[model samples]
Target: MTTTPALLPPDIRVFERGWLSSNNVLCLGEQATVIDTGHVKHASETAHRVGAALRGQPLADIAHTHLHSDHCGGTAALQAAHPDARVWVPEPSLPHVQAWDEDRLTFGDTAQRCARFNAQHALVPGQSVRLGARDWQIHAAPGHDALAVLLFEPEHGLLISGDALWEHGVGVIFPQIDGSDDFDTFNDTLALIERLDPRVVIPGHGTPFGRADGGIEAAMARSRARIEQFKAQPAQHALYAAKVLIKYQMLDVEAMPHAEFQRWLDGTRTLHQLHQLHRPDLDWPAWLALVLAPLFGKGVLRRDETLVLDGA
Candidate 1:
């Protein structure tokens, strides 16, 4: 299939943003469109980066796989810069976005920040959108986020798997935390990705990779292991979720005082709910004080008397 060269199509380039934002896929041609706009905190940087990539080209449209804070946080800022740029989001998330409901959109619930933005159009499933000269097929992908979607370009065998199928493993099964059994659906999504047999995958968080079979197989195995582990010990998953959120915040802030970190964790309603369901035995202050231990011991984070640094 000569997958390598074709998979790295010049029209589709990935701007590899770090944690807290998904990679922005730049599809340039007659009308420029960007998939995912990074995080709101880095909106200005994202705009400048994309602008430079375009070389004076005006960004014309934006499409998101999901409404996760990181993926669409820069939408409002980007729209303000290019007021004519059309924004599209998953159809299911249209209402929450239109209402600017941070809670419903999960920013507020998770204690994360996302600039409010309006999506003028919906990224409807079973339809194709023009990203440059090619038509990218949109398919409903519900695993990490119930409403996430995957964009596939058949001719090129390129897939924008979003967080549904990352290079390493799928994103957190957030539906579980929200009291939904989504492991089966997640498995189905992975199977679908495997069936499509993409030559290259531009995932939501990591660098793009080629030859999906090995990665997909490895990721599927890892996912099955994790799912089985979670099924047996749900609390472990809860704790993992808590740590992920903390690490995400630390990635954005780089560092924070212990008091502020504690407060942030305390205020994160989603984490709190996970804790309540799985670790309710401990009181707030006690759990708060001990919760960072595992992450610290694993070298995922570093903590001093008053400060928590990013993997310090």
Candidate 2:
């Protein structure tokens, strides 16, 4: 069933966004806070929307479920807009963020962009934080991003599931793609969500969905099936990831010249690693072509005589 804003607590507002950015969760209280700002390209819009939603409530804090570029890219803009707002990031990410290590943070590796921002606090798993009038329990949610966390409010059975859980599927297993044994960790995260038994889930993307009456079960089943396939044939997962990255880049701009697209594909270190690990025989250009053919055939992307465009 569809979940509407009215279904959420009166003080909470969710701004569902497109693929380029993650959904923004605004928790209003004596200390107004916003969780998971969108990508940098949409930073201004994100700031404007958040400002309007606040209705003049001084933004006391900004929080992140994880520091993926899409999830935290607008942070710098938000901080500028609300100078008094304190930023809170995951405890494990605190060091990298403080040092501004884009490599360790995965921004450079993924060829994604996030303007530098600072954090004044960290969200530790198993701890609790108050947002609006409720206390949220923080739980470690790795696999999608090794440092990710999910927030749960027992009083309302509401879960703020970042990329760990979505309506159709989970986020790409970056740890696995990056040469870590994290498929099991991803499953463990799904199991943890099952034990929580939330009544509703505010996922990082798409509309929030009810977990009661088979919604959560169905989503889990689909996610498990997808992960199992990846486990059985990891090369397939690598190919899938390549397409996702390409589409994500396309979403950031109206169009790109073929040469620029090739350069981007060349520079994305993660893609190169995936290529080396999964299809070394084909070479980079051939591998890229193989990955792009399906995206073009499905109309997920289109190419003119000189430029590539986002098809949908």
How well does each candidate superpose onto the true structure, as a TM-score? Answer: 0.91, 0.95
Write model 1 residue lDDT over 100-163, tens digit each, in one string: 8888888888898888887878888999988766789999988788889999999988899888
True-structure Cα RMSD, model 1? 3.0
Candidate 2 backbone collisions, by pair: none
Q: lDDT per model, in order?
A: 0.82, 0.88
- Summed backbone clashes in each candidate are 0, 0
lDDT minimum window of 10 residues, candidate 2: 1-10
Off by over 4 Å in 2: 1-6
After superposition, the stretches of candidate 1 with alpha carbons farther than 4 Å from their true spots are 1-6
Best by lDDT: 2
Model 1 weakest 10-residue run by lDDT:
1-10
